[model samples]
Target: MAGETAPLGPARVCRLPPPGGAEERVTELCTALLSGFQRYEQRIRARQYMDGLLRTQGRKSIANIATTLGAPGDEHRLRHFVSRSHWAVETVRQALTAFLEESGPASAWVALPVSIPKGGEHTVGVSRHLSPDRSRVVNGQRALGVWYASERVVAPVSWRLELSDDPPTAGRSTGGGPAQEGVPAPQDCLRELLDDVRRWGTPGPPVLMDGRGEDESGRLAALFAGQVPAAARINGWTPLAGGHRTVHGRQAVAALDALSPTLRTHRRGRDGSPDRRPVATATATVRLAGTGNRSRQENRRLTLLGVWHEARREPGELWLTNMDESAADSLLSSARLLHAVGDGWRTRGAAVGLRDYEGRSLHGWHRHMTLASGAYVMSAISSSSDQARSSGRSP
Candidate 1:
């Protein structure tokens, strides 16, 4: 299969072991996983998760897993491990970290819809009594838009933003108390995502995300040094000067109010322009309804309402992140990757990857899954590499 041809993404199917030594591919996958070990803790978690999943549940367990990487006959073991609430949380965190490390260095744009279920009464890590699945309350399930970027390589990068928490159980409700704010704080989530990529031990490309990353509009002020940066629909708003509706920034209030309605859901590459189409955006300038003031407000609340016309593909669906404004092509590339990864998820029987199975209470299922999945991705890469090499061509 070394010299044979194969496409990329879903259209491409990798061959089996090549006639050449399989050592090189194994080395590459291992090295890749190791290089990002510290940056992406999921690698470690995945290995462990797999170990537990592949273990003989009853009595064939090893003395101390930490002491043995992969025990003898472990491959034949098969009694899946479960995850606890805390372990599930950490496992999700680790998976996100790994995603950043593996693709952040080479990607200039990435976006994913993150679900931040309001902790009214059913949140696991919070003291709320809310359950989105209850069907009694209106406007349930809040999601913080997410984005990741690194302007370094050309690999197709994607982010699968999924919720790690459990849904509200029957006959339970969480309507009182403060909402359990999303991870890393609303304002810092975006920057924090970038920080995770930074730990990859490699210089990353320019990263861009949605408003969730830069929660308050004021955060956008600290761009790549004065270049009013736009990341597709990261902030979920178009371009406004004095911040958007009720946003606490320095744009315009009228500029902000007019945002929601005027925002375009989608736009084509050649938007009726002679030379590669004019960059048209779903823009508006208005005063937010809630906030009365709209002048040179210092940290005044405004709304960041924007639907990037540039990266809009599916009609009625808004591109809610910075990618819409910044990396149009990269956004497209990521969308495609997401579609391919979707298949893998169904095949593997889970929406989130490199995660452990969650059981009630405080089980350590997540660590086990992360360990297994991390090892799995590595193994898959190696397998593909071997198949390519076997066909007589370098992968």
Candidate 2:
């Protein structure tokens, strides 16, 4: 059936919170979006158009947000804000501080991972080799995000997105057919992400992330390699890498040629049969191939810092973690918290993976990133609630 043509609809009038309330909600939502998840800009903008002009587009677009917010009655200015915005990061930070007022005063252990989406050729932060796909020709800016997981939490503590660039390639170009080189590395973007997290400063549990260059056994490791109880995914050998094991939502499987010599007991099935002992936990770093002079020995000091408490693996995905079954499994068994942070943008507002819906041109495409780390942070809160409710711990 062919779709019918429609005229400009009447201005939407949504059930928006009053002025003070609206601001508060906006701040609250934005803060949760920023500190709690990556893709703050997309989220913040989506919230803004929940009521008015944007609503006319659909429930998923910025226009929908305007309708949700009761149209704000300021079409001209509001439209402009929605079209071009970049204040999401700062706004989210402000909201977090305001929220921490009550949740503060407790030790907080944090874990964050920055995911680099693989696609595109002319992306500002695109690089070669760092991508798992091994696409000599990369696409889009490299995405490095941070996920925060509090000590007492099981789900994500929060999320952050960092668009980073890498050294340029010599034999790769569009029109010229693979013959361009001499750009720069994306070390700056990595530096900025670290600096931002440090400024956020936590007085509680030590901060943690996957083994980053700065995360050595030093005083400034964002994620302390020494303690605070953490279970991370590992690569090649790191001693802590064990046979297929899982920690709550985190799963660690074997990697191609990255498996280590470690034995572990696993549950093959419901029957109490002991699955052949898999390797023990292991962790190590590798200098991923890039288009630069950063040699393997110079930047690659792979080591097993500590044992991870979870096995972070995806289905049919190979993963290695520096964790033993006894240690990593223990944390996984006790886990019961989870949350997520994601951001998506579409020129035509269609679902990201879909073939076509609406874009000015035929080849229009949208980019959406959903980061999942600190999945433990949210699960922890859920566990606590269920336990409290079940045990009649209510006040």
Candidate 3:
């Protein structure tokens, strides 16, 4: 097996000694989990990069990884493997989806966000835009990504880079090549990404979003109608409940602000003590915007839950969701999910070089994100399995 002719040019392969403990587990993971890459050479290259990403302390750029692995000569080869290769990223994503179905938590929320920070404009999709937090303006790649959260797990499953309006004009010039065609607007991109999940036969969960816009017209409600329920943070000024109750005519935040003070209805505080802050909840059916080609507004009955803290002097939090009257329960779950997603982002960036890519091509971005996501899930599953083993139980 050491000298077999392989798909990648004329490189000779060597078999490693049989493993015993951690090495064996990692080797098995590299082989079994990444089986979607059919070609042996592709698998080898992928594992190599993943290993480097896992082992290197910081900045998992191709050159850094190549140097760390003492294979400086393979830098160009690995770069080509990521940017110019024809490997199917979709297959790996499908495998991820399947794996989640087998050992994952019950679907709670599908939180999607549409931006990642970048330093320069040369890379594909890099443009000037408001940050996702909307705290300031920044230059970055516009990306639409889907993250799934259950009781115990949160991980990114799909991503699309929003191509800038001014894609590189020239063909394969020195800089990062031209941007790929067929990039959709951010809203449309979310639908496309969700459609991919549908194609995988995955069931829909509540679409949780923050900071889309004033949902007075309920455009998002119409968009996700009949597919899955949705939860979002609407602009404070959006109308609700036909102007009847306190929550009807006033801005969403103001309505919640005027409610009588009550203790928080959700879980205990981070320190395991009961929260004493005032909270409020309400429900209403708002009108949604048109769907497809129709210009007419559609009616979508939704629930609104709000919590106000006297110390804050404003509505501390608000939610608009189409879940049952128990929208408060879903809000609690979705809030935990939102927190988990933030933690996962930090972990991915630290453990697997989520933001360390130096490649500039469209394919490169997708390939990097796919591998990074796989690495993240693999680490999570492996850790979970080890814990179960220590406890003498099956995972």
Candidate 4:
């Protein structure tokens, strides 16, 4: 039962300076995001909560944050503001999306799957899920993060929590029903995220994600067909047909294996020396297994890209893309953006308490994530500004 315990109670209050530099810029960002709260007090409380998140160290539980802000008595008020307030999370997300758009042009829209390990089942959407590496099982909340990524800056603007069908049997009541019924599939959740981006009227950038299994690849290929440009890694054994070379049917690995490397490149090693592992890339025109009722030839056509290492006999990586101009370097560049999202989440995201919320309500989770995302954006912007100024360039 040690790892199954909930977070601890509040501690004594302690005074800490606000999150270092860029206070004024972060304040401006908070003002833009919290504008939807009609009450002035609500807006102020939201600002305080963000400040607490930014300033708190270690596990950013509400109690710890409250203590760090030297307002231990306001803990309950902050809790209620996050869990029980009627603030619209979507409005803040839309505003954040607008803010990111105005900041600069995004290179790619990356979908990042975040798995937060939790100790208790009472948290909303907490369930047993496989770790990202699939090495072991973890009890946690699974959330899909939509990130707006560019060459210099990356920030998460929206999030969707994956709710479990089983109800928690701890201190929470479910009225003898599941915690939430008819939970959407992963693809559906992504579609909903895309819908939000579309509704926000932002430019549609190429979508990127790690290789999905066969079933998901098929569904995703159909979803992106004629809808938007996308580049998703697919499993090597995924079936495909109808290449430009009149191939009848073959697995992705086989299709890519038949082609020679069209491009080759090298990268710097960890110690600043050139890495010995040479990378090669190749491409073939192919189509996913299922294409539903679309007559346009271009809609059904997709490029099958294979990335190989000098040491491997077969292609080491396989990807599928529907972009109009699928250059090898362009697709490779898009794939690199996924790393930016990962790095941002691990560093700035953790620092801002992205996974530190201990509440159990759906609304509370959304509110917390929205604010945490704002915190990440502020930190990223601040860091970018610092780097630009140090490099003698305008931010």
Q: Name the lDDT of candidate 4.
A: 0.65
lDDT of 1 at 71: 50
Q: Where is model 2 poorest over a 10-residue stretch in terms of lDDT?
A: 1-10
lDDT score, candidate 1, position 122: 31
lDDT of each: 0.33, 0.30, 0.58, 0.65
Top lDDT model: 4
Residue 264 of model 1: what lDDT? 34
Candidate 4 lDDT for residue 315: 59
Model 4: per-residue Cα lDDT at residue 76: 94
* RMSD per model, one decimal: 11.7, 14.5, 11.5, 8.9
What is the full ranking by lDDT, best candidate first? 4, 3, 1, 2
Pairs of residues at least 3 apart in sequence or in different chains that clash in candidate 3? none
Q: Please provide TM-scores, in order, for all candidate models, with all chains considered together.
A: 0.43, 0.39, 0.75, 0.79
Worst 10 residues of 4 by lDDT: 1-10
User: Per-residue lDDT of 221-298 in model 3, one digit per residue for the tens?
Assistant: 434455476776554444454333423323543443343232234433322246743233344444432333233424
Reference-based lDDT, residue 55, model 1: 37
Tens-place lDDT per residue, model 4, 141-191, is 877778887765678878877767664422242211112345656666677
Clashing pairs in 4: none
TM-score-superior candidate, 2 or 3: 3
lDDT of 1 by residue, 203-223 (tens): 344444333232334334322
Q: What is the lDDT of candidate 3?
A: 0.58
User: What ranges in model 2 sit over 4 Å off?
Assistant: 1-59, 68-76, 82-88, 97-101, 104-142, 151-190, 210-232, 237-395
